[model samples]
Target: MEVIIATFFYARVSTVEQSLDHQVSQANDAGFEIDEVIADHGVSGVQHILKDRPEGKRLFDKLRHGDHLVVRWVDRLGRNYEDVTDVIRHFIRSGVTIHTVINKMTFDGVTTDPVQQAVRDALIGFLAATAQAQTEANKIAQRAGIEAAKRNPKKYPGRKPSFDRLKTELVRNLINKGLGTSAVAKEVGLTRQAVLRIRDDPQGVEAALQRWDM
Candidate 1:
């Protein structure tokens, strides 16, 4: 009897329009024939763990022995060191292999040499730590920028709303219909925070849209 292995690609993006085409393109460039692609759109990696995410939960359930999991980077797997390493270790222990497209890094449980295994583990830890640190740094920078903007609102009006007229109308209608923020967000394919922004001050959002002539 013979066995066949499957390769799966996973990705997470913060915005709806940010497609996984780049990651898929990278895999193709690397000569990997992906059997499946699991993606979570409009999801924040900083807030959700693999199992907690919509499509991410499927990865744990679907991946099996001899399966290969491909990701663009360690950060895509998670936002912090603990979560990143935990997910990777879980997959490896389950007889699945992990490969990163960026650096061409590979992690598997098939190695027998103690020293080689130690080196691999160390590298994983280092990369995961670095990714976590980067996430924290980005958050800090964003906060600082917001504070600066507060000091001068004219100079920084903040980012424009993501929703257009149609989506905005849809969100407003959902809110008017007495739907909860979470339900409205799910229905409109938006984040809860985005829904809250509109719910908190529909007037303000409208004013901004009018001001910007959007």
Candidate 2:
């Protein structure tokens, strides 16, 4: 194992809307001894790669040889597969190690063997592609729900909840993405009970949103 000179944790979060609660703690819990915590607040990983984010740019410039970059997932590096692969490759070439906390995936730029290199590169490609696919699928689901909600908006007759259409959309989308009630609720800033209500009666919630012109 190569000696790590430093470890940095980076994440992109819409902190104004959501919370940035566990990113650094998660990395530490994953056994990465972080020397610094760098977060690109109000940035969407789905919309911008690490190079475009303010703090992300700093991260790229600050990393040095024998340094390790720890993230919750490989998706934090870029917005799409191409960008993700490119960024990972660039850092690896610069002798920086990239590791994901989820699977404990590590791409340390220390290997000379062709087989080890191939395996690591392939894993990076696969994870990046998977993250992109998930993002696309969530968008598709949200769009479909919106279109459906627009078709017949006359089912609701009660008071509207505190969540607006955007929050409702996020709730439904995350639920469709297979996130549990607590996760979806926490993500969209809704109560678990409210998320459960939306999950059990998506059409009702959509109709309520329409009623309020949300």
Candidate 3:
């Protein structure tokens, strides 16, 4: 049998400006020799399912029996409680040892002690449920705010876009010239997805640009 020992790192951030390097460095400092890292940037854990995201789905396909999956924290694995438990359980059942760099937590299926197993399972379940519930509450509040905004569009001021007019024009020009999103981000010094979003919705970009001046 292949010694199937590997450490997989998962890093996630809710915004394009957040750095994955901080999480990577933390894991490395904790003495885990990470073989590969999978990240989903500018993606919300509470709203997006692990299996639904492009990078998140890619990670699901890479894990195998005997592989070790590591994360900065339990929250890194999921946005909600149910998702955290579901993903962890799915991998644990497949013989993957889930490790968290913070507090050096480990969850695996090999525990033989009934009491310890029960305690661990209970904690996992409780935490998962809490996370999911919190996520739902956030979603509800967000929906209410959005509905209110729709009712009075002038009352809700959205997030300000960080880029300047020069960057915006360059980003759009790059796409119009047939450049890929990644390339545009590289040239304009913005995240790849941000460039794509700006290209797709010029009106939104214009709105954001207006905020930059204020």
Best by lDDT: 1
The residue-by-residue lDDT of candidate 2 on 4-25, one tens digit each, is 4888888877647645557777
Q: What's the lDDT of the predicted structure labeled candidate 2? A: 0.83
lDDT of each: 0.88, 0.83, 0.82
Please give me the total number of clashing residue pairs in predicted model 2.
0
Candidate 1 per-residue lDDT, tens place, 1-214, comes to 6778899999997776666997799978987789999999888888999899999999999999999999988889998899998999899999999998887889999998999989988999999999989999999999998898767756665577777667788998988899998999999998998888887878888866765567
lDDT by residue for model 3 over 1-214, one digit each (tens)?
5576778898887776777998899989999999998998888887788888768887778888889988887777687777888898898888889888888988998988989888888878876786677778888999998988867645665665657788888887888899989888988899877887788888988876665563
Please, what's the RMSD in Å of model 2? Answer: 15.0
CA deviation > 4 Å runs, candidate 2? 1-4, 15-18, 154-210
Give the per-residue Cα lDDT of candidate 1 at 37.
Answer: 94
